[model samples]
Target: MKQKLIFFIAIAICFSSCENKEKNQSVILKGSIQNSNDSVLIFYYSDKSDTVFLSGKNDFRFVLDLKMPVYGYFRINKKTINVFLSPGDSLELKADANRLEEITFSGIGADENKCLSQLSEERTKQEINYEEWFSLDEKQFVFKSDSAYKAQLIFLENLQHKFNNLNPFFTKTEKARIFYTYAESRIAYERSQVFSANSKQKLSPAFYSFQKEINLNDSTMVFIPEYQIFLKTYLDKKVYEQEKNYETMNDLIGAEFDIILSEIKQQQIKNYLLHSVFRDHLQFNGLEGAKDLLALYEKHTTNKKNKDEISSLVKKWQQLLPGNSAPEIALQDELGKIHSLKDFKGKYVFIDFWATWCYPCRREIPHLAKLHKEYSGKNIVFISISIDKQKEAWEQMLKIEKMPWLQLHTTPDAKLLQDYQIYSIPRFVLIDKEGKIVNAQAPAPSEKKLRDMLDMAL
Candidate 1:
């Protein structure tokens, strides 16, 4: 009986100790912003976000329950500052909205936060002359890049020496950031060389020796932005090297998705890369040829959250499939007259979702005009809808271009944009005479395919 009683007491004590440990792990972040225009502050930690409303005095507080150390950011108005937080950290931050770079920190986690702020300032200085750096020859770039990385490492090391109690996670993640940032710059050199000079200069094998140092499947560094960027650059280089005679860019894109799915062994890293690929594919290429990649993604990815999100996105795009009733959007013409797809129900509609700021949309105007003239008195109509937030800019563009066809305007946040899944500008949609979608993602006017499609429709 005494042994049983002692066992129960021991179990109770263990539970109590665990509960206290968890409570101590909670992070208390309180901050104040001076001369701020925004009422709310956002803290982004990995994939999670916490929004806190600022008080009348422009002060805010966030109590984050965390099991481990994390690198996060505090977004104040248009500017964001880096923050490194650990379990039991109680940090106080102060900044002026106009001068976020001069942010100050205090309290338990103050040293690390201050270090991150200083490091960010140094990174900005390094990138300030990026175009000049990118213009350097391979040898010059390597020398410059190596020197910059060495300086960054020395700077971080000096800070670590200054702050003796800095968390090991912060130091480790900072080192990873420095390493990946250098790696990304090295990988990007080839692209810059190719695009800037339009020359396919053969790079020596020694140029890419940095690639040997990379662990492509580092799941621990997945949340670090620099590491994410390096992985993307590395994958892009790999795809470029492996490119063969392909029928279309879509074929290359499809192969790229397959490469990410097959080559990346780390589950979290795979999830991030796959999610990015799908989102980019959907935005630029639309739903065409996305199914195979989606199926592969579903098979490979074990993240339920990412899987659910991708599934939701796929469902949204599915609504824009051919033969579906065209999404009804209320638009206004130059004179503020309302119009809908129903107004042109008996005419084949070639809709242009564009903005005045879109250069591609401007380039397509001549081709669109020619098509309108050729199809005059035919059973089709060309409609250009401006998604420019500034109504005056849309009106000014219509007047200057003197486009003969129908001109209309809608806000960027219009439900029509959402329904059409219009994330990019210069998006073209084709509707049959009966108001059913012929193609939600139609070929651009500049393409021969568009003329062929129109001829077939007519």
Candidate 2:
């Protein structure tokens, strides 16, 4: 009896120690990646992220503090897996890179992960007929999709009930996420039904019966990834239909800002969506319009961190502010003839920084040609500079496309790329006749405003 009492006392002490460690910082993640020799692994919770480089054998161990019941991401190589992280959790994971869908997790945070893994695998199996379903008669499509959604919900319910004993918090949150995910899928199908029913493509009006009542304002549902996407897409579609008279993409985006400000009540999600929209579409239009949208977003958004991020982006963009002298660039033509920006002085230079592999850049060739023709004898020169490493591909495309502009192939030197700060393909820059920058990030030739700006410069 004395020995038994001593053993119990030791066990109690161990439990107490573990509890104290959890209260401090006791998240331990250890894992191995099969078929991977060495790779980088990344994981993150809401505001914190860590990257671990595996040296050999692709084994990893990470210890960090994690807030409980938060959505977290685990990225290995190029594959990403979602996880629910909780404090005091010690998770051991093993995954085969060849068969990524089949993963095994065992430890404190294992039960919920196991359930999620199985559900994903099962859903993939169940969706083997997804291609047929898309081509199915609309009536059959609705019936099958609804049945699948119901099955998913039932499976989620069973999972929550089964895992309730292991981690009630995870079960509750995961179930809610699954439900909202189905809701998002259902809405997407309903929206598609409207399109598919053009002249009655076999879907009865009853196909949309499920969407008659939906809780768009479910604050908690916003946490679901699908709902996050659906909400933004739905808002964009709505704004597109409502704001019929908008001129530029940025103008439509500014109206989207106004719509979100007035309609979206939840400050966090509202600001997040608004900032995302503004940052993406604002620069495609004029700089003054972008500045106006920035001011509008700054005035309305309540997220201070988002405001700071926008401020940083604005500061970065201001590096190409108009009136800044164009960066000095020395590029070579197809025949090994070197040319500098000084050669184009006293002529308005409409420059395209592109690569042979860039599809969008190729698509703009004809438009750039038309602009070149439209502004002939106007003291403006169209300069096409390729960032292609191979001159052969550049020469082949230039021959095939029969581009009339002054085509040059060049590697991106550091100072030129840095001064322009062009991150995306098919970037256009407008230099005034005085050798000063007019619009460092000018509109594309496809955009009518580019012609307007060119005419103004002429």
Give the best candidate by lDDT.
Answer: 1
lDDT tens digits by residue: candidate 1, 1-458: 99999999999999999988998799999989998888888899977889999999999999999888888887667677788888999999999989887788999999998899888888888762568888777888888999999999999999999889888888988998999998888878787886775545677899878878889898779889999888888888878777576676567667777788778988889889988776677666776766777787788778888788777778878888898888886778898799888988899999999999999999999999988999999999889999999999988888799999999888998888889989998999999999999999899999999999999989
Question: Positional deviation of 222 in candidate 1, in angstroms?
Answer: 0.5
The model with the greatest TM-score is: 1
- lDDT for each residue of candidate 2 in 274-340, tens digit (9 for 90 to 100): 8778766643433555767777887878777777776766765676678878878787887788888
Candidate 1's C-alpha runs over 4 A off are 1-16, 34-40, 128-130, 194-201, 248-250
Cα lDDT for residue 112, candidate 1 = 91
Clashing pairs in 2: none
Please estimate how well model 1 matches the true structure, expressed as its whole-model Cα lDDT: 0.86
